[model samples]
Target chain A: MPYVNIRITREGATAEQKATLIQGVTQLLADVLNKNPETTVVVIDEVDTDNWGIGGKSVTVRRKQGK
Target chain B: MPYVNIRITREGATAEQKATLIQGVTQLLADVLNKNPETTVVVIDEVDTDNWGIGGKSVTVRRKQGK
Candidate 1:
């Protein structure tokens, strides 16, 4: 069984987009590793911009700083 | 910064339990890898019984079979 975790900054991804992502990641694992899609698990986590940081600054602040 | 993804079977974990897990994982990463907890990302994925499988059998089916 292959478990895939995807993280993205919360930007209001539609349910359809999430579904597509789940499907595509499952397919990619199956094609590359010959894993069974039925046994593959894909979970998506959407983090708030304030909670997600890079280079010691939150994404929200970084974006505001035009970085 | 360390990004940690935790996967567990969906068994109705309480909000407190999840919060504890997130805190513990963040602490572990900080202690062991010297990562910054403020920048550490810990996302927990609780998989459905039907979507999580082992030995080619879903957890739901396996549970039903008492396996």
Candidate 2:
């Protein structure tokens, strides 16, 4: 069983969109990796700005400072 | 290019253990799927008791009710 984990930026995508994305991923894994969707697990995490970092900066602070 | 999403039990693992698990998963994906670790993204999500389900029931409620 292949378990897929998706860490999404908070407020980037709606819950419905996330669910659909997971379903699409599920299909991709099944078709591409020859895995079983029943056994495949997909988790989408919403990371807060402080919890996420990019370009050596905290997303929360950068956004607040309008950088 | 392969993204792996792992939805973990909220309290089932410690942060260190989770990190190790992610590393292990990264290795496995590289070996089995021939994916690159740098490009492979693994996301582990800790779910609250009320949010998880199994065996047609909520894991949180079942644990609380001791069922």
Against the hidden reference, what TM-scores do the models get? 0.55, 0.51
Candidate 2 ranges beyond 4 A from true positions: A65-67, B1-45, B48-67
True contacts kept of 1: 0.04
Best by lDDT: 1
The candidate that achieves the highest DockQ relative to the unseen native structure: 1
What shift in Å separates residue A56 of candidate 2 from its native position after superposition? 1.4
- Candidate 1 stretches with Cα past 4 Å from truth are A1-6, A9-67
What lDDT does candidate 2 reach at residue A20?
Answer: 65
For candidate 2, the chain B TM-score comes to 0.81
Kindly list the per-residue Cα lDDT of model 1 for residues A1-67, writing each as its tens digit: 8989888989799999999999999999889999999999999978756545454445566688897
What DockQ does predicted model 2 obtain?
0.07
For residues A1-67, what per-residue lDDT tens digits would candidate 2 score against the true structure?
A: 6656567668667544655666677788878988876666665567788998888889987888786
